[model samples]
Target: MNTATTLPRGPGRNGAPRRGAAWLMLAGALLLSACTTPLDPRKDASLQQAAYTTDRPVVRPTRSVSSFSDSLMCMDHMLRAAQVPTTLITSKQVIDYSSRVPVAAKDMIITSLSQMSRLSNAFRYVDYEVDIVRQDTVQNLTTILLNNNLMQLQRPALYVSGAIAFVDQNVVTNRFDAGTSASRLDTGYSRNRSATVIGLEMHLGDFRTRTLIPGLDSANEVVIGSGSQGLDVAGRIGSYGVNFNVGRDYALGAGGAMRTLIDLATIELVGKWARVPYWQCLTLEQTHPDFQRQMRDWFDESGGVGQATLVQNSLIAQGYLQAGTDLLALDSPALRTALTQFQIDSLLVPTGVLDFSTYERAMRHFVTLAPDGSLQRVGWGPSGPTGSMAENKGDSTPVRTSGLVLTSTTPPPRRIDMQIENALPPGMEPTFEVGEQVFVSATVSRTSHMYCYFADPSGNVMRLTPNQVTPHSLVAANQALRLPDWLVPNPAFIMDASRPGTERVACFAAETDVLPRLPAPLQGAGLVNIPGYRTIEDIDKAFQQGVGTSGYVKSEVYWKTQPKKAQPAAAAPAAPQPAKR
Candidate 1:
């Protein structure tokens, strides 16, 4: 473990405060300093896989203007990174649910429509021009928008909501827990399900006024049943249901409760609203109070999340936005004013009003939300696409690309290797005599040596050896470090042991136990250097010298550079050109 100093003690018997303090500390240290054996993850196999914890704040906030952009950006990012459901509004993906399935499918369609409308103008997309007929057993759905007027807006969105209810209990389908699997634990009373959004859709822009929405936003949720109607129930096609044990065989499934199903469907609708805001949807009318605010947030403020104050400060810094009482006040002239304000470069803040320069600037910063849903602010400048503010400009510090190639293909209990390019704290010692091991543990994630010496919050700097607190110029308080609890039993915590003399490099992983303390596995010298092989020395060298990249240059440019000059070298520069001089 890293060496630590004990502070002087309080006076005791002979009024020798320092001596008493040292002795007391010595006793305490002696009692706790013994080397412990490593822990193991195998101790508990169930504690695997990461789950979303409640520590993070929830939802898109309407109070803050930038909150809109932040939510959009995060959603955009998550969509690109994962298989997000219902990514964006389109026709094929969001058809009327009732038309696609049985009459029971209306709830999902209506719910999705309502949610889309709240999030955009398509609040009633599903309800638009929909004709449900008990006689035909089919619903006719038509496009709600008139000649794509809404698609032309700066920010546009669509919402759809659907529902269903079966009064006379009948057989629907063998609904499983997830609807994809089967189990003997089936509901024996009435097997029915009213799934809605199994169909629901949207197009860009407005679709109100006209019979665009087939139904209404206030739609009912479709319910599916768990239990079956007993007594050898038979339909026109086949026989179903149990002959006996009605009550004992069927418990009230979550889907079985009509009230519960409706409430759940409502929650799904509301949850969509809580995630994607309407302003970005561009569905509301011109008179809506949020029209301007919505546009500003989506285009002016940097789209980011979990960092609201940061966004507010950014808008204020540009003098485009400010908080006034409860309402956000925007400087209508910000777009115009900022055009000349930056001889440098920045995204064009979308001032509600557009001018020649405003449009010019906007085009420069037209960050199209890519189909994948990830976004990058491109300066549609004369030179064309440039790097996004989020682009890695290749700082002097080393940046390794690794980890979280997470996928359904790989089940839980996965292990990943993480290496921090820079982990040292500031005021790192110039020289030190190594006589012991430097312990590495999950706690390293919290330890900040740089904070101890320097007065900044940029995390660690000039750190030497992680773990173990020391009697240095600075220290941290409230070091309530949290690590994935399951890994605690593993060597996730450590107290290093050092030889008489040698430097130790410690790498830490979350929720992992220590390696078996086998004698130095290699028989040769303590340090063996490999040339091509990447080792600790190599990593440290790479980190120090900034390897992996020669710094950022376009890959295509370098690709052609390797080829010989295509234009034939000017015929030896025409030796006869001397006459012109």
Candidate 2:
């Protein structure tokens, strides 16, 4: 009877054993959930990650003004003293190696020399091209032969020749890797360094004597640094992982390198030939004692106010003046007004007088000459924020006037026309009829990158400069470029009978190509209409309505078109020939 009663009691509700089993099941479910969820114990902890980095450095050649300024000044003085007409004939091949340079580089050297000649009156230069010279020669010869008159050609006393040589070498290499075993991140860093040594040589030869000018052979070397960088990153957490790498290299084009080399070479050669007194301006204590004394006296007397005119000119040269304003007049109401405005803009004390503080502030806007004679521009240091003249107003440094007035004379030396010719049928007056081909010949007064376009009678504008034919925008000085190489009004486009009127062929010239900024809707049925221009005159008016300081020249030609001719009456039945009777 006792054993039967014990068995029945096993089925009792809310027993201790049943409650313990339910609690055990709940605990097991919680353990399983914890095991399946992602866990990060370092979620809010600051831990280092793996990193990899690489760098390539490109070093550019720098100009040594002190080393060459003396020679340049000497040459300038000598050329002025001699008063001889000179012609500089630079070798087309400036580099001795086989590297190719841009044609613009050669032209740039010539342009630089020509500009120097104009500014210093060092020598009378012949700025004409070979063709122009030949044409002039022919005309002179004809006049001389027909009139029995004598003509003379100015010859050069010395012919300058220069060549550049270069050597590139890797100088240094570095690599680094760092990481902790407990972290899932790692990083690596690497750097490669290289140097380029450029050698410049120049010699002066006498064409008449067929000998080298004594003391005119010169050579110099410039060193430039170049390199590259790379970065690598890799990490993993259990099955999850990520890897990434990137790299870049640095280098300069042959054209740019050659340009820098040529400029330095020309400057040095000119200096040597002229025998510029290298110590005249540099050895201020020796040659200009009295001048230095006067500068000191002036600084004390006027506190930099005496040189207001110089400061104003410097401001104008630096483009601080608003458009169409006259140069500031010294000691006048106009000058005071301008100075006050400039001070306000530059965050100065707003004093209208050209005090020492004002002079010092203005000088910071320009290039300065270093003690070693190198030209240094503000904010161009290797390890500092570079500043530009455009940022002069934002500079907050207090003006320092210690030696400002003494350097008034040494104010940093700072330093487009276009023509369009219409090619029409012989004896035509730049006018073309329907179905007749219209060709345009364009030339610029200076070397520039240009953009050419045409607005047709249908009010559609088409790009002509960067077209399929001549795909480059570099237009050399005085060089002729023909538009639409093969006669316009052909298959792609023809004179529209319904919209017969004047079509304009316009060309814009600038030191650099600015075609990308041209208004859009570049290609459509009525682009001119979108601009609200109905006629060529309206387009021209709109085109001229831009800031005049853009350094761009616009020239256009107008051509008219009429209805196509009727098939010519079928030759009028062979004119009945009267048959060559």
Candidate 3:
């Protein structure tokens, strides 16, 4: 046995590494793994917002230009005439004399005009995408029958055409340099600038007549600019040299500039077509005081027995004259006295003669006799029906005797509550997928005549109620009418691929049947082939001009086609087993 040498250990130290240290190392690693890298504010923020901070409030850049919607609305208000059915065709080259024009410029104009049609109710746009096959002059019925592709197309009344051009362009550049001898450093800078001008011309014409509308031609110009600057520095000390450069790129390119010009031109073109007030919807020549005076004089001199009879009937309708007012007694003192009194009440000169102003005012109050012989308020138009009792041969009553009796008539005010619900399996959202069945239910608060219609993604209106099954337009008070019934899970409409956007349902109810007058197809089959009833404003305006008081409600639902799922890939064959096992 030999004596073993014992080594002296350091104070408060372990001979072997501490086990706790290993755990400490592991914990440190976990802490580091949990921590995330800090994000740079400059890189994370959007370019539009990065320039602003807490002290520097964001100031949006301003431009003295009109937007597409603004121009469309302006045109709509100015063009108060009935909507015209129109077709827009683009030429092969939308922009002429310009190399920087986008290939899609023609498509852009077409799409913008289509959108304008929807928003303004100014035009009913018909799809121009149709296939036509020329036939021989001596074609027989067999040939026609064999070519089933034949279609009966509706002709448009108006056509719009236009072109764009690049007028001029220029560019400039400047450079400068500075150096300091003591620091042995040099700095240089250069600035480049460019500008372009573009022009547009548009024309509108009557498609059938092939004649340009008097004041529908327009021209506009737009200018765009861009600039950039660069700086460079170099220094050398004891055979060692260093160089650096900094530069700023041009913010806008030629393509972007051309697009801006095209948009501005479109706004100008719409303004001209619509004859907007400040933007020149109507030209000075058309609205000159001298021309208007001449027109008034012509109309005044052209009055005849027809005009006198119209004035007499309108006065009777407005309750200014009692029944038995003689239409043939235009020169009667009683008629002249009544006309003078009406003129005074209307804040016009007390002219005993029925002048144009008095005639116009009286016409505004003209009343219509319903089929049941009840007097109803109706708007005056060129095609408005006449109310003369003589027109009704079966009725023996004279027009003067059949005048509406003046009485206090007031409609009771009532509120109508409408509710729309989706009848599908409860899920995250009440959205429908294309090809899936959609069930919708509607209810009203009171027993009334309800007219329900839906506007699809393409602005088509379809009548939902009063269909084959639910023939009656009236709904029971507080009763739910489940659409398509229980047997039909999906209504007459299906969520097709083309209709993959928000669909709106509008319902109007009244104690009396107050549905707006619809086209023949809509009233019978409840299908809207034309782009009608897209805006609620149109529906509301119709109700206001209708015979009775009513209330309305609207609801919207989203429809979309579900994205296809990706299939899983097959697993790779297991690695070959080693040789010989």
Candidate 4:
């Protein structure tokens, strides 16, 4: 065992103990002072990875989207179907009282409209008063300088105005608490949740008349809920105590809710104004009451001709009717037969009539169906082909006129017909053997410029007309023109069935020459293959862009080919032995 001995309280010789204490105090003071200035890593610590560093990589940015993003795209197609004209529009900064919401309402509206007009620009936004103060300053400068060319503002046709009408906080609240206590320990847990309501309103106004359009307003709201929970336990014995606590919090973002509300309102306003079937984008089926109302509204707006066109287009896409059939010809036997067949297939009464019910059924599917059923919003333009519009000049053929003069009041009817040159039974789609020679016959409703293309089985489209042999693209009304015209001697233009699949012949007729405006492949000389036109849908889209929906009429005919059946070699004459026998 060791015994402890105590030292005297008095100082040692020369006050050595006190001096030692003083040295310690001085050293501590120096250390404390050193902390005021950061120590250089080179002097104090090795330069390794920082203690606060993490292994996570930086996150890449992606496009921001809300729940209604796809709905906005679907709305774009609706506007295209209606052929809504592009109009200039602008919006004032949306008013908001909730500071938690994003302050980019104007930008959100512009973005939504842009997405809705991707196929056809239905709205062109003009930044006129984005910054009122800057706008005023520029206006003053322009006025004072007396420079007429200093600024030019495009007058907008419409203005969109809106506000975050209300943000009701803590509209609903709930809490739950539970706990168990033991002899010397206690534990408890608590959960609480609260909901808030956000409302937004938007209105469309006629900028020219300085008046808000009646019935073109939207008011929508969203509910955001937040919840959090916590748990804790404590134990104490004598003078000691122990405690633990954990919490969880979850809530919908107010900013995202506000954006969603804005998007919904934009869809409502534009859809109502354009008179389209907007409910389709909202995931509502055609049987829904809202959809029926909207559909009826559209039906009333689009008259008989428009309804017929819609049905015809749908039928063409479904392969029930030939492409490029006259949209206005309701009494045609071919159209009636197609309608009857479509009705039978759809399990409806085969009336062969374009009644309201038939049109409604057709129109509903038209928005959702594409040729391959993979419709997407894509940008298309003329793929450059080497040639000039002048090259489309027709050859010196005797002109035939019906002594009919076209006037503004009597616009030429857009109609075209296509058929195999010598199809059996005269009106049916024909089939040919592989390597069989084929010719296409075309006719127009009036004296018009025509361009024709043949899409082979391999999806390669070749321009069959306006070739060097038969340079005449202009055809007299009601005159049948055969490809590789029999009139031309030693015609180089030839179309021999090559593959064992279906091929299509498409012809377009327009009162004014639209050949130059078409894709480059369609405007080339000789039998050149049209690139990128892989399907009849692709071909139709190209013509729709070049000649527009109303500027020209188109017709299509299909023919199928198969491998020629090998004729069994005539049985060899029975051996001479058989004759001898």
Candidate 4 backbone collisions, by pair: 324-554
lDDT of 2 by residue, 1-581 (tens): 45544544455665877888999999999999999998885773443232122233343222222222333443433443343233434333344552433335446556446534531344433332334344587665655664674544445555656566444444334444443343787666566666666566667677577677787766765555566677777899798998788777776444445554555566656666665543333432212213323333433543333455445644553333433445455667877866765565444577687765455445443434344443333432222223332124455543322232321323222112222223234455455547575555565644567766667777665556654444577765434455543223343332222336777767767655554444443322321234544444443443444323345667776666676767756444544546565
lDDT of 3 by residue, 1-581 (tens): 99999989874577345656887899999888767656566775676474566557454322222223334433433432222223333322354656654446555555556445432234444445322342343344434644785644456766666676555766333445454444677667777777767676767667778777777765776666677777788888878888898888664454444444455455555656544453543322222223334334533644666457656655555544554655657678888877866665444576677666665445433333445654433322222224433334566543332223222122122334332233333345546555555544455544467766666676676677766656688765434455444325455544233456665556666655655454434455554442455654555556555643334433333444353345699999999988995
Stretch of 10 with least lDDT, candidate 3: 402-411
Candidate 3 wrong stretches, greater than 4 Å: 1-66, 73-92, 124-149, 171-183, 209-214, 254-260, 276-506, 509-581
Over 239-259, each residue of candidate 1 has an lDDT whose tens digit, in order, gives 443323332233333222333
Lowest-sum lDDT 10-residue window in model 2: 411-420
Q: Following a full C-alpha superposition, what root-mean-square deviation does model 4 have from the true structure?
A: 28.5
| Backbone collisions counted per model | 76, 31, 2, 1
Model 2 CA lDDT for position 130: 36
Question: What are the candidates' C-alpha RMSDs?
Answer: 36.9, 22.7, 30.1, 28.5
Q: What lDDT score goes with residue 481 in model 1?
A: 23
Order the candidates by lDDT, highest first: 4, 3, 2, 1
- Candidate achieving the largest lDDT: 4
Compared with the true structure, model 1 gives a TM-score of 0.17
Best candidate according to TM-score: 4
Candidate 4, 81: how far from true, in Å?
Answer: 0.9
CA shift at 147, candidate 3, in angstroms? Answer: 7.9
